[model samples]
Target: MSALRVNNLAISLDGFATGDGQSLEAPFGHAGERLHEWYVSTRFFHAQDGLPGGTLGVDNAFAEQHEQGFGAEIMGAGKFGPPNWQDDPDWKGWWGPNPPFHTPVFVVTHRPRPSIEMDGGTTYHFVDAAPSEVLEQARQAADGADVRLGGGPTVVREFLTAGLVDYMHVAQVPILLGRGVRLWDGLESLEDAFDIEVVSSPSGVTHLTFVAKPR
Candidate 1:
């Protein structure tokens, strides 16, 4: 079966997925970059960014595992770019020439826009439908491969609350953001609905995996 997974999703010690005031300059917000310090220092991330010879450890291993999975991806409007920028004709994406995603990416947006083809076989498909509709389209495009939930908390929260996600891997960072975009804010009964398994690495990053119980 094809699983819908969120891999290497970082969350603060206080359960915030992203910090406040997300913009082009501050993608993750104030202290949000601290959550991803482990990833940035990994060899896997370096290789993806066209660098070489990074630290080989638990962090690198986890990063490599995340980079390998997911044939297709689904991101929210905010995850792609600013909502207002969608109306502009010149704005393409935050990534200038080459994007990190090498597979087909379907972006959920209210506004309509033409498909954008980027380098490395990555094409962004703008979907004007609901989250379920976008997931259905993504499943079809994935073709037996897993669908990755790429997001800015809101998108992932929707999928989780809807009980559409098959598996989720969240990397709980050691830092505390205090206040920001939370990952489990909207879900009222998530703990009761799904079974969560916890795993810890040497780098103090905790991985939480959630799987829905059979109904």
Candidate 2:
């Protein structure tokens, strides 16, 4: 079976994955790209934009890991778009024609929409299902490759509570989002099930890897 994983999920020092007031204008809300500034300067990010001269170090190496051995993705409705995006029939996604994800993406939402196929082999399938059901669908789409849990904190917490995640890599940024959607909510002593390893990067972000222990 392919693994299910989360990579580069940046949370603030206070454990907020995203700040409040999310909209088309501010996807990450008041957080304002602060969480991803570490990867934005990496060669991996620059390569995505067809650019050059990005720093190649710890952050870049970690950023590059996101592209390896993943065939499908599962994300929450919130991660798909801002609140009430379902109302807009024309809103494809935050990404343009050629999105970063080059696989079938299963979006969990209450109001499901018809699948939207985009350029670069990315297709969005909106459905209402539990984590295990969605994981099964994504696993089938993966076809032997791993499935990535592209999240917005709430989604990650759901999967964590269900114990569906095989591995996770969370980048802890040095900021305090006093009020927002938190990642660690309802998950107490989560470290008990997963063996964690921490690595600090020069960019001032610490990467924490959680590998599920044998049951």
Quote model 1's TM-score.
Answer: 0.91
Among the numbered candidates, top TM-score falls to 2
Minimal lDDT window, size 10, model 2: 53-62
- Cα lDDT tens digits, model 2, 47-127, are 988999798988888898898999999999999888999999998889988888999999999999899999999999998
Winning candidate number (lDDT): 2
Task: Provide the lowest-lDDT 10-residue window in model 1.
Answer: 61-70
User: How does candidate 1 score on lDDT?
Assistant: 0.83
Model 2, runs deviating above 4 Å: none
- lDDT value, residue 16 of candidate 1: 91
TM-score of every model versus the real structure: 0.91, 0.98
